[model samples]
Target: MKTPKNQFWNAKYSTLVFSLAGFGFACNLAKMLLLPENTNALVFSLEALAMLFFLALLFVAINCQKQHEKWIKEGKEKSAKNIKTLMDENEDLKKRIAEYELKENEEKRFASYQEKMLRKIFSDGKSATDKEHFLHLLAESFAAGAAVLYKESEPSGQFIVEEVYALPEDFIPQPFVLGEGFHGQAAQDLSPIVVSSIDADMIPVASGLGNTSTGWLYCLPVVKEGRCVYLIEMVTFKEVEIDKMWNEISTRLVDMKIF
Candidate 1:
């Protein structure tokens, strides 16, 4: 048990055993030579006793060395296991940090894109024609390819599609009544509507020379002068974000002075 504790103690114990064995062997040799005139049996017995003590000390020295080596090997094994555990935990922490940074960067990028569109809408001429061009610009930026601009018709108070971009060859011009359809419902509620799956028959998009489904539709009502006066409908080939996209667009159009 003492040998299994500290290496310093084990080394000291072995050294002490070797020193005692040397001193005992020297004393027995001196007694046998200097006292040669004594009894032969007594001298022989003293020599035998010294030899046994030296042998026992040698055994203790070797045992201590073996126990120390075993303890050292066990310590190394334990240290290796602990080091491996720390390395695994460090790698997991690094992965989590990287994932968080990626998500934050994505949110910032989307916000920047939305802000750029807001500035583009306000940098054009104040005339009604300029507003239609702004709508066309929005369609191009969002990859929608189809955009319709509606103004509240005077006296009739109907939300009609006054201007359009990328209309199909077979498309017909229609005005939306209150709560009539998706666009109408958004106008009635003064809210935004998003349709992820598009049916070309029901919701048509004019791309190039033909009518088709773009798989995504968004309609927003622009409120001005305390009434829902305008509506913008967009059809896109790809899925669009709901909150991030529509929220910014509606917020910008709410204060826009171009009626």
Candidate 2:
């Protein structure tokens, strides 16, 4: 019970053996017909053996040629697969590099905007007492719907709204203590507070057109001599670069004696 592979090899070997034996027999018959009087068996055997050796060498050469061709074809296919893998890797690397460059450019533009904002707001030669002008500047800079400037009242020791910008005339600002609401909390912590995606139920911001729920709110406290001197609240209908604005303000606020 030979397997298919064993059967194939057996068939091939049988064919080669039969072909060699048939050639030897044919040669002997031809020699007998050509030289009837000189019947030398040794000469016939030598000629037959030489012919079989030549045929075996030819078969060996042909088999080696086929094996060489098979090796070449396999090597070419493997090389092609390797080349395709390398090309795919190169494309992936290109995408990653492109993403990194885009992110770097965005960061650069954000930094530039922050730098300009710092120069415009802190170096305007306007005193902190000019609360209205300051609020107007901030509202315009951030595209804010409304803005409120609160200053620490020397008499009451409470944060009181000093100025308002772009808000309705009827809207009144309520004063608060150090730990009261968002503005007071920012002042208490000496940090900035950001609120995003406000609900309609919360306090609505009133503009010249009408009252609407603000999308974003920012509360920033200006500190001087280890105490919060002012708190600024900005409301916008769209998101702004609040972190960049805060960074610029905090870095430069310490230098200005705005108290």
Candidate 3:
């Protein structure tokens, strides 16, 4: 396809060639009328000039046509490149969307698993409950091995350790008085406590005799009817998605016991 610019130049060159030819013809006729005795020079000179003009114009027209073809070819190539770039970008966007949806689905599935575990723990109200079995279920859910449950008592305000799932053999189960350590503080304030990393020499993993957890510890207080009723603790080796664990799992600890 020829561009508008190429077509305009073609027309302009053709017009100039025709105008030159007409002017030469008019000059030849004038010369013939003025000197009929020596008309040979006028005829020969005008014919030669007109022939040269036509040859030059023909060469220019051919060159212009070639240039026009080149312009059309270049335009097509540029369009093809742009189309390829756009297709690549679209594929990248689609891959990103697919990854996001997959992540969302996995999160929902894990949250569902956490909820089901809670429901199972409280399945039979009065049935004989096994604290160890319940803790094992919790550990499996979190991909961790250790678990603990605490019960907060009245007036004296002590948090007694009710269950220990996978503590080390040397570790002892004990109680925590209010304001003693982070665990005690969590009980007193009725809030959740998360230690991303534990330093054994500095903080006590167990309250009574003081044991180092040696890993991450999560302490959550379960409040009921304006009083803190329970404190659930767990120390795990792997890093967890803290916000998701807190939001989806910890909140369900209310009214739940190790039994």
- Best-matching candidate per TM-score: 2
Q: In terms of TM-score, which candidate is stronger, 1 or 2?
A: 2
Tell me the tens digit of each residue's lDDT in model 1 across 1-259.
2444566786787789778877877787776777656567876887778778877877887887788789888998898899999999999999999999998999898788767766665566653357777777777767776778888885556776777888775775577676767777777887887777767567474321134564677777886655678888877878756435664566566655555
- Per the 3 Å backbone cut-off, how many clashing residue pairs does candidate 1 have? 0
Residue 31, model 1, lDDT: 65
Task: Using lDDT, give the best candidate's number.
Answer: 2
Q: Which residue segments of model 1 deviate by more than 4 Å?
A: 1-99, 126-129, 154-157, 197-212, 240-243
Reference-based lDDT, each prediction: 0.71, 0.74, 0.67
Candidate 2 per-residue lDDT over residues 124-196, each given as its tens digit: 7674556577678777888888888888986644888788887777877677778777777888998888777
TM-score, ranked from best to worst: 2, 3, 1
User: TM-score of predicted model 1?
Assistant: 0.52
* Per-model TM-score versus the true fold: 0.52, 0.58, 0.53
Candidate 2 achieves a global lDDT of 0.74
**Model 1 accuracy (lDDT, Cα):** 0.71
